[model samples]
Target chain A: MDFTIILQAGIASGTVLLFATLGELFSERAGVLNLGVEGMMLIGAMTAFSTTIATGNPWIGVLAAMLFAGLISQIHAFIVITLQADQVVSGLSLTFLGTGISLVLGEGLSKAGTVSLLPNFSIPLLTLIPIIGKIFFTDQSILVYIGYLLVPLSWYYINHTRPGLHLRAIGEYPSAADALGISVFRQRYFYVFVGGMLAGLAGATISLAVSPGWFSELTTGGQGWIAIGLVIFAQWDPIRAAVGAYAFGALRRLILDIQGPVLLLGFANPFYYNPYLGFFLQMLPYLFTVVVLVIGSREAMRKRIGAPAALGNPYVRGERGK
Target chain B: MKKFLQSEWMSRLIDALLPVFATLAALIIGAVMLLFLGVNPIVAYKALWDGAFGSGNAFAETLVKATPLLLVGLGICISFRGDVINIGGEGQMIIGGILATWIGLTFTGLPGWLAITLALLAGFLGGAIWGGIPGYLKAYFNVNEILSTVMMNAIAVQIMNFMMRGPMLDPIQAAKASKIPQTARLIEAFRLARWSPTRLHLGVLIAVILAILVYILLWRTTLGYRIRAVGMNPLASRYAGIKVPRYIVMSLLLSGAFAGLAGAIQVYGVNYRMITDGSASGFTGNAGFNGIVAALFGQLHPLWSIPASILFGALLVGANQMQRVVQVPSALITALNGLVVVFVVSSEFLRRRRQRQRLAHAKMDDAPPDKTSQPAEASA
Candidate 1:
């Protein structure tokens, strides 16, 4: 019911999704639909959690997470890009692998006791503004602040930069890009590695800031998948993805925030009130994801809006496909 | 060029050997990982092998684990071959189990065969419906099956949780103290009969028969041809006057039914009661994901999934035993399974590359003599 409270919390929590969506945005734009965002996120989360615990520095944890995840994503890049395996299968298996590896490595970190999560702070100049400042800029985690800067930076990078154009060109028509002397394979590998590192950072945000600490397959609760969905829902646009992520974050927060009142309000009939009514709240975000995906897909297909032309297919020079 | 990877027979040979080589390579990688983790790889593997296949009892457990995997993998084969990824097997399995549990609990005094048949049918139908939702969306609305299926999984889990805790709470447990999420034991007549020593039940037979059935349905039937044709080239299939969407729906439905059967049989044959620990893994044992791994290892063939599932089953059983003896967490096995999947998929990639190379070589060789055949071969 408190709009500001929900908005603040949504921005704080949605940073995880924003990072993931941005990461996926890069990979998809490069024409390699890396579905292993979830996997990379998990690896990042585990590395960040454990590293932060060991080194007592959240920044160190973030760096390791990105490094480990980016390094691991080479396996995916090898299979999908260089080897030309099915991207979806490779991505799913990467997730399965990532989840397994992270959990195996992270099992002891959580039980090793409480670890320091990245704390929130407000900018002095920005916090001094009116109601706008309080709603938009106050007391946010460093990740959320980074996400805010990331939005415009990504937008500019994707739409304005020379390298961004080349990335887009390769994704849309690798053969044409190859004809133009662009190394489609190298560019794809570059983006996949970069995207994977971002995904790792997203996972670090979850462990170090969002949820704090680590749990077995903790990110498996569909956030990574939702982040992938956010890419589509954003029509592969950066700013749009940011809005979508925050909106989704708000929706995710609704599950925890609404258990008491929203259900009671939605089901006005007294007979519908059950003690376990709150259990259905857990299903909200997933259901929302499906609904959003359907609509996003409908829009994308209807208008042929914003997807890269050769999104899921791997490129093999001089090889014909059925 | 030394006849390297040439000829269709040679390609087939590689296809057959690829999985074995991949499995070995993955095991080697796993061994390296174990060594890095400060464990003795040989001793650990010995424990794993002994645990999975050492004795008659262990072998029986492997069969038991393989049963559900084989069924689900076969189901996934249908969907994957049709180019529709039905990742919602976990949801399908959960819904199917609940349906079977309901049938077992609701119906009484019926003959055992009739009861079991009805229960199985209910489970299959439940899973089919659960799967059909994504299928229908993909067919009519162009929705992504993978994401839709994932969403369906979440909804399915919530539904199971609500039902189990609310109305379906084992009446006996309702009467007593209960923290564990479960239903009361099913009626005695509905329980699957087990063999004396192995304790493996009728589900193994069902799995074998269904595998054959899937193989036949995929290769022998016209529906199968249409599905394959659609999967190969939807635009071409559409041009050829095939209804592409229908095949997509059919594949997903069939896949869901098989997954549902896996769930139903697990309740009847192994667990004997419908229970969940409020996590997808606890109820489905990650069988949904494992099934995908099996299907991939099997080269998407139902017949091959039998051995693939068995191999996966052995790994799981072995890993559990290894965990107990070596003090390694069972999570390591999951990571190991992921490793196997990656290796198998990568091997598939290499195989395809080699096939492409062979085709290119063959084209060049025939270039001078086969001017007339060039166009025909290009299309073929």
Candidate 2:
């Protein structure tokens, strides 16, 4: 396997996951666990594909995708925040709603196959640089740079700003935050909206930047779940989340590059003749997620891991103290 | 007697009307979407109804679809009433099918009745094992059951995929033929005999019997009392000397067993072989999740769950017809299911609000009498 091709795929996948995980980080920090990221991403991918095909402007399509996903996720926020619905159920329902809606809307568009791919941006000096610059900065869509930029920007907004502190406080203890006159509802609404928009952008990256095509049921294949797991692996830190995404992305690419293996020491190795070993390897992320969750549940591991304190709990105004 | 009749009638009316109301509201929402799609909502719904229940065959299809749902829904009811969210029904069902297939393949010489019984037992044990893991974790480690169960589902899917593609693959098919990964079909006698022109089997009767048994297990037994008590308030139950953790584990095990039985019935009655990628649609097209919706709509009661499963089954059958007749997506059914769940959950809050309003009005009416009494007491 060529190092450069592997590097390219890694960067591309990492860009998609980074955007999704960063968005999820914001939502969780605001005390909302959005399990519907996959749904949002799927909606985003479909919208991006359709809009880009219709308008022939990848940028406009990306914008449309973000707005579409954000608007849909608003329903989730409305139920969880306003109606005090269970967050997990609301999130699961959001996925069903999003997937159902996208399939209905995207069916015709997918059949048409009119999606136009986004053009790559190349910087002269950066393109000439060695492996590091080639993988990170050159020969990628503008959105890749945008995704990279979002990491630190998200970190700043979540750690240094007043709104950030309030968001953290709401996640840690919504009652205390409400008592301090920070509107938990407004903060949650804002973060959820922002999270939805980012998720939309992440979906757009898949359709517009990475593949730039419309394929039915191809938009989501559990990358959203991986992004959620990345948020946990990063301990809710945005920058580290980006790193985790890149690592997962690299592992995925490495597995794809491995070929021609038929060594069997036992009676018969299942992997020796199986052509679908590649597909099984693709499932590594989910396996990793389960392993991390099991580890995270341990008392010693939990102390080291960071999760939003009030995550999945509804916050009502008058019921703050109680 | 008149007052008692009125109260009883009103209670029954509310109980019956709530699910219908929720279902109607969900349909209205779906209809609005259909209108947006430029399809006539009335025509679509009529198509759906005709598809699900128009003829003997269609009705049979609905019943067959509802069989697994009935089993899973009953399980959901039992677990949910005991305050355990057993989302792993799909996984348990898969494990059940796997175990049944294994037994059916290995013990070919056994008599039909004994073989079938053994298969069913294997299914129950398989599901119990799958579900009991999360139960043990939740009971002992304080692990969140929702996350743990969801994770187990993914693991079960992988395990099922591995078995179907690897060890359990049928030997008759050619290597390059792209055969469906399934085991050999069960012997004829071991299979469910067709009772009518339709494909409804004796398994439906088995489902009904299990439902009644679940009802008895949840409402009649001392163990049932302990489960309910723990569900109401674990701390209170603990103070009352109930082993809350044991009940949690036991309830989950029972839930899994019912789910496993559903899978076993599916294999022996319908599919007759374990298909590869059997769970691609996730829990055989989300029968388990829909079972949750059914259980909730049925108010977490086994007796009510039978009708609820039938209704959901009709919806499934109808959605397929609606897709063919009106050219609308079948996913509208899923959307409708979600809407039903949302509305049903919301009704509880609405009832609470109404109760609070009535209490406030009663207090307001008694305010002047209380004020006058307070003045008299002060003078005295």
Candidate 3:
């Protein structure tokens, strides 16, 4: 397997996880843990594919996917924020609801053949940087370019901006933030909406750019859950999240490629010899997620820094404690 | 009117009727979906109702379907009550099936009753081990149970796929060109007794008996009390001298055990062997996920889960008939199940608010008559 090609494809696929992991980070930072990312991504994938087929514009498909997924996310917001329901249950049900709605709406889209895909082109001067240029700036999907920009922007926004401070304050100490005139409920809802939109964008990136199609539940393939796990590993930091997402993307691509070759790095490849061993290869990403979570948890314990304090708890205006 | 609304009977009535209301709301939405699909809602629903209950045989099929759901629901009750969300039921069931199948295949010379018991026990042990890993992770390592369980489910699915296509492949099928993934037919002596003219098997009786046993466990026994106590308030339970982590682990272990039992029953009573279409849902029929809905619909009470499982079982079994008659995708049922869960959980807000109001009212009654009463706005 060629290293350059694998890394290139890996970056394109990594953009999907980047968007999803960042979305989940925003939601978790705002103290609303949405376990519905998988469902939302599926909805986004279905909408993007079907809308592009109808509108003949991949951009419109992306926009529609974001809008639809964002709208559905409001259900979780209303249940958890307005009604004070359990976040975990509401998130789980939201996933179910999202999956069901997408399945129903996406019924025939999988077999609808091809539509216009997102534009892909390389940057002029950036391509001259040798290995990094070939992997990062070479004819990549526009979404990949957008992902490159999102990482640092999100990091700066969360760390330096005034509103970013407010976001952190609400998540860490919502009751205190409420007393200081920040509308915790509204901000939580908005952040959850932002999270949903990003998830939709991730789904759109998949259907329109990376691996375009609506293949039912397999379209997202539990990447959403992996994103959630990534958020923990990143400790809610966007830059760290990008690194984890891209590495995971590369690993996922590697697993598929490893099974294809008859020989490995000048040795016999067992995966090629016994195709059944590929099943174990398929388990790596998920197993890696578990390992990542354990490491994140242990680090948090050591550092005494972890998830937002009020992450899974609903904010009541007159609550006694967080 | 206020007094009547505040009565104990009124609370019970609302508790009983809320799930019905949620189910109805979901069905109404599902009907609208059918309309969108270009099928007549009335015609579609008629097909669904008739398919679930039109004949004795159809009803038997519904019960047959409910068996696994009930078994899984029992586990849901145990885990959710212990405040552990065991989404790994899908994985636990597969591992359980694998173990039970192994037992059935190896110990063929034993008598029917003893062999079946040993196989079921093996199934429970396999599930417990599978489930206990996540439980142990959550309890000791501080990992999120939901994410871990989900990961475990994925791992279990791969393991199932590997087992069926690898070692567990029926020797005869392995020789064939098609190589369909399945184990050999379970020796007939080990199979659960089935009534003629219907697919109903003795597993249903076992499930019903387990439901009663679970109810007794949750209410009558100290172990049940400890599990519920941990769920209700782990900190308080710890302060009260309970081994919080141990119970957390036990709850998941027991929860997984029941799901494993369900998987064993499915093999010994329903399918007569382990098989797969290369996906967890293919073999488990999504019963692992559906059981969560049943548990919620039953108000998280073990005994109430019986009817809840049956109701969902009807929806699943009848969806096939609905699909045939109306040409609407059976996926509509999955969507409806999601809607029902959403509604059921959202309705909980109303119950909680009313409960708080009742407590406030009780406090008000104890106050002196001369003090004017103020409305408790905690409902907000």
Instruction: Choose the strongest candidate by DockQ.
Output: 3
Candidate closer to the true structure by lDDT (higher is better), 2 or 3: 3
Candidate 1: give the TM-score of chain A. Answer: 0.92
What Cα-based lDDT does every candidate model obtain? 0.86, 0.79, 0.91
* Residue-wise C-alpha lDDT for candidate 2, range A75-174, written one tens digit per residue: 8898788877777767866776777777777766766664667777766787777887788777788888787788888899889999889999999989
- Tens-digit lDDT track of model 1 for B349-376: 7777787787888887877775455555
- Candidate 3 segments exceeding 4 Å error: B371-380
**Candidate 2 C-alpha error for residue B23, in Å:** 1.5
Q: DockQ (C-alpha) of model 3?
A: 0.79
* lDDT per residue as tens, model 3, B306-372: 9999999999888989989988778788889889988998899988998898888888789777545
Q: Which stretches of candidate 2 lie over 4 Å from their true place?
A: A2-4, A122-131, A211-218, A259-273, A276-280, A299-306, A320-322, B1-16, B81-84, B136-144, B222-252, B277-279, B361-368, B372-380
What are the per-candidate TM-scores when only chain A is compared?
A: 0.92, 0.90, 0.98
User: What is candidate 3's CA lDDT for residue A312?
Assistant: 93
User: How many Å off is the CA of B289 in candidate 1?
Assistant: 0.6
How much does candidate 2 score in TM-score?
0.88
Instruction: For candidate 3, write residues A67-145 as lDDT tens digits.
Output: 9999989999999999989998889888888888898889888899999999999999999898899999999999999
By TM-score, the candidates rank as 3, 1, 2
- What clash pairs does model 2 have? none
Residue A119 of candidate 1: its Cα lDDT? 76
